[model samples]
Target chain A: MSGLQPCEILVVDDNPGDVRLIQESLKDGRVPNRIHAARDGEEALAFLRRQAPFESAPRPDLILLDLNMPKVGGLEVLRAIKASPEWKTIPTVILTTSMGNGDIKGCYEAQANAYLVKPTDLGTFSEMLSSIQSFWLTLATLPVG
Target chain B: MTQTPAPAISPITLHLLLGDLPGLATCLLGGGGQVLEWTEGAHALLGQGREEAVGRPIADLLRIPAESPLPLLGQRAETWSLLTRRDGSTFRAQLITLPVPEGHLLLMHPALGTPQPKEETVRELMELRQALDESAIVAITDAKGDITYANDRFCRISQYSREELLGKNHRIINSGYHPKAFFTNLWSSIARGHVWRGEIKNRAKDGSYYWVDTTIVPFLDASGRPWQYMSIRFEITERKRVEEALLEKQAELEERAAALARSNADLEQFAYVASHDLQEPLRMVSSFTELLAKRYKGRLDTDADEFIDFAMQGALRMQVMIQDLLAYARLSNTMEGTQRIHLEDALDAALANLSLAVKEAAPTIRRFPLPVVMGDLSHLTLLYQNLLANALKFRHPGRPLELTLGAEREGGHWRCSVKDNGIGFDPQYAERIFTIFQRLHSRAEYPGNGIGLAFCKKIVERHGGRIWVESTPNQGTTFLFTLPMDRSPS
Candidate 1:
């Protein structure tokens, strides 16, 4: 096997408060990576599709998504990205404010990589973020694109 | 006794001795009962006032006259004779002869009404008779039950003429609707001089049957012995007819209401059985597929192995979705199990189960004062599992996530919220996500069965509560649901 590039992560969300918290919580990762940001699912999908605005976008090894969004929701973006052959292989984690059974069931049916109910408390949110970072970066064997 | 007989007491002097008599008339009868001088009082008292009394013999004056009381007096002259005045008034008079002179003096005593008038008394009696005629029915009988009088109302109701019914026995109008004993008892009471009140069925003179409620009273003489019986009656046919109709309608309504309740119970039972039966096969499919993946991991080609993994994952997801559906169907049953549960402990257990995942995700989990709730524990546990696991599962590649859980009391319930900062979804898609198998992502992007929120919905409903969500893409997400916080028994 030839040597591969390091796995990259893409985060699609509009809230700066959430962006700050996620950035702060994911500290204990053992992977060689760069964390990128997209304001919405549409932007995230555009990045993955190698569109004009995202022409120099690097292929994301993993994606962390929000189900709710302006223009393109996390579920729609996930569906669009997963249906495209070029970006279908990337793992996506759905982080959303919905705890309803229907929301969870629908996310899985639409082929989300993972579904998570977002925690509001700063302490719980940090722990949850750190754990996710640890699991995906240290234990997970994500493909280097 | 003090005066000597003088002037031989002429006829005029004798008339003066009987001064101011109401019908005083002097009559002088010569020897051999021949009339000589007869006083006017004599003729005025008898209506033998025919002036023929002046010269007639005494025997002729005592003869019966067609237009006078003379006829009655003539029959029984010595004891008492009736004298009729011009106004149809009568008086009782007795004659005594003076032995030496062979003359007569009449002493008169009249019953008060005889010389007065019968005009007012006759008028009052006539009015009473008219009132009786207009009443429902009135009949009078002697103590022996033979008819003596019947008012017009009675005659009309019975279709009988007064001539035919005046002396007839009461049995002549018997309808025979009542047994013989009923009549015997009624007669027995009346014979004992007691009033008898009852409903009687009678046959009319024209052979028609009619019913009347009657009250019969016995009239008594001075010695309190029964002399006559009077009966008044009324008809009651319409009242009886209405009572019968009402009784029938009430019975029919009671029967219809019972049947409707039975049908409603049956429909409820059908829904419970249908959803329960459908869940069994889905569970079997998922468990076996999971087994195949665990057992045969490395024995297949890459594409084949991947396909199997995808198939098993899909089956597991389907199983979760079906279970959520079953939970929804059984909500009515779960409501019965509502009880107080320790939220602190429930949260600890949820964290414990996801401990490995929590450390792996490294999310900042903060919990505030959580309220205990009235809920089904097993269902609540399932709901908590999905929510906690969800918090840890969705994390951006580099950014940290913050989660806070809190509660507020409102409307007799605690509205609990779980907040998280990750890749939050948009507000518009919030309503669409909480349905069974309603996924918002593709298989390659996320790995989940997508039934967690549906389970939360079922649990909230079981507690007689509601759940909803609010979020903005790239912003934070918040989930809210309500539950009774103090459903403890007193």
Candidate 2:
């Protein structure tokens, strides 16, 4: 059942409610997948570097980041992720409330794969989540390990 | 020879007896010197019948003062005195006594108050006449309106000497501002016994114009018919000059206002042409790049593919900028027509249009009640689309996104704010970010051509408002802007 080792995704956020929502949205109404959440950017980076307890963690195939958090921010995470050749190949998509010109430009400039604004309405959120599954999980052809 | 009983006492007899008479007199004096006969007027003065008093003497009835002219009449041939009569009243009398055929003759004439006509009174009246001639603005014309005499003031005010004015007609000072018919009518009206009084503008001897308050009076002969006219005038040149200057300034201001209006219209037209002309070439460049990029993906090397992609993005950016510029130009030139735009509805439409990115980020947003603004639905739709997309796109990587939308009242209108926890920028570039084609981030940093914020700025400005941002790097951004409820106050 692990077709191509179900694409690994790293979700970074401090808010439990949003992390749960994103986890539920990404669980595959279309493609079956396992989801992991990091409460902050630092923990998310630790997971990506496979250090300590996360030494057995699989390399993430994609990252969904929140811009606001306690320890390190999403822009910093994007920068660190894109800087290291070990993790640079993994796609990073900015998933946050920010629609600022500087924020959008900053994340993409730090080499994020995509940028997305949060929809306030529920129906739209569900639709967007489903479409994300369709586009990234189905349409986008990533290099297979 | 009963001697006609001698006409009792005639004026000649009264004149002979009142020695106080100036020229002649006669008196009848008896032994006691009682005044006997007076002139016929002396009968009026003495009140004694001549027959009765003829035999009496003067001393029995009248008395003389200690220092008296009546006695002096004997020492000096004639005397003047205040004489006391029988009634005890005084009279200013000149007495002369001359013996007549009848008896000792005396003449008395009482003199009352009679002012002597002095020569200086006549001389002073003549001086007054000369003073009026000097002080008043005066001129005398003959029966035909020709100048017969002009005083010094008349010549000075008219800028003409007496030599030049004398014998010349009133037309010498004519300014010609009035119609010739005006003067002809004036003369004809006055010649028919009417006095003509009017203010006039007259040319001076040096060819400068002067105004005057003038009155011309006609003098009549003994036959009660007009024989001459006298005109008096005072100069009013300064007042006339002020009036002319005020008129000239008013005319100049009117001309300037008309010219300024024309230039403003020309500027509007130029804006229209410039933006419209740019759109055609922009479309060609963008479309050709996309064609090359699409058709040549595998054939191009890494650098070539990258170059082609950058070129296509640039062309596409140019196309969007041009479209926004054209829209901005039209917004200003066209008159504003508005429909109420529902905030939630427009916000929903914006999200619907932005579903692709929303899915990619999988963000969570919070919004409350919103305000409806007066705007064209199309522009408002685009405005919401751009703002929503921006909020979704600037999210943090590896984080769950949270966005908030809200509205508040500011400066007589509603301000919609989009607050996000995205990667924020420096606040110094807030004003510059709204300028056309002004971008804070490079194409490598952001996917947009930097036209979205500029478009939003234009929409807000056209609605008579302002837009700005507050941000710090790595922190969230709050985009605050206002839109007028209506173009004009409701």
For model 1, how does the per-residue alpha-carbon lDDT over B378-404 read when each residue is reduced to its tens digit? Answer: 677767777777666665666887889
lDDT of 2 by residue, B153-261 (tens): 8888778999999889978988889998888887886776678887789888999888877778787654556778877776667876788788998888888878876
User: Which portions of model 1 miss their true places by more than 4 Å?
Assistant: A1-145, B1-336, B487-490
Model 1, residue B17: C-alpha shift (Å) = 37
lDDT, candidate 2, at B109:
58
DockQ of each: 0.01, 0.01
By summed lDDT, which 10 consecutive residues of candidate 2 chain B come out lowest? B67-76
lDDT string, candidate 1, A20-89, tens digits: 5566555444445567788897788778877869899998867889877888888898888778887787
Q: What docking tier does model 1 reach?
A: incorrect
> Which regions of candidate 2 deviate over 4 angstroms?
A1-145, B1-272, B275-317, B328-336, B485-490
